[model samples]
Target: MAHRFYVVSFGSLGTPDVVWAPVTDTAFQLDFEESLWCPKALINDVLTANRLRLRVASRHGWAWADGYGRAGVSTVRDRTPEETDLPARLIEGGARDGA
Candidate 1:
């Protein structure tokens, strides 16, 4: 049987918290709960206290779903010219560089 893949981003992209697990809900929930280390605490509590954020995505159809897979692919496009130039424009507008 084909399996679906789930990408869980706990903090930010490329961070160690970003993980891909198989079998949909079960795997993700198990891993997430383990990380929290608080079986009694609600998931919402962990999110609020740690500022934890999650982004989940899946590929259409199915390929394989087994244990945690690290070979998953995620691509990020480069910033547009306008986006890249925002910092310069802000600096010109009297905004401090690091502020």
Candidate 2:
């Protein structure tokens, strides 16, 4: 069976900010201290929506490690509830009304 995995980069708030790459090799060794594993499916939704290019960059970011022997999926939050509420706040403040 072919297994798939994702390497993700997270922001300071522990939200996944970027997807580094995907590997099918379950035995692939990662720089364990610096990175973590996530399931390919979990990241696929975001990857498809944003059309993000998957590639590893710098060394500091959060990662999701599913408990399964194979990589697992986790809930990915692109922004905090407060962050997502900004537009609503702006609209309520009349910013959208050209105030």
Candidate 1, 11-97: lDDT as tens digits: 323344544433344654555444333323454454322122222222222111111221222212322212232222322332221
RMSD, candidate 1, Å: 13.7
Measured with C-alpha atoms, the lDDT of residue 74 in candidate 2 is 16
Give each model's whole-structure lDDT.
0.30, 0.28
Q: Global lDDT for candidate 1?
A: 0.30
Best by lDDT: 1
Candidate 1 lands at a TM-score of 0.23
Off by over 4 Å in 2: 12-17, 24-28, 33-99
True lDDT of residue 38, candidate 2: 33
How many pairs in model 1 have backbone atoms within 3 A of each other, for residues 3 or more apart or on separate chains, i.e. clashes? 0
How many pairs of residues collide in each model? 0, 0
TM-scores, one per candidate? 0.23, 0.24
lDDT of 2 at 63: 28
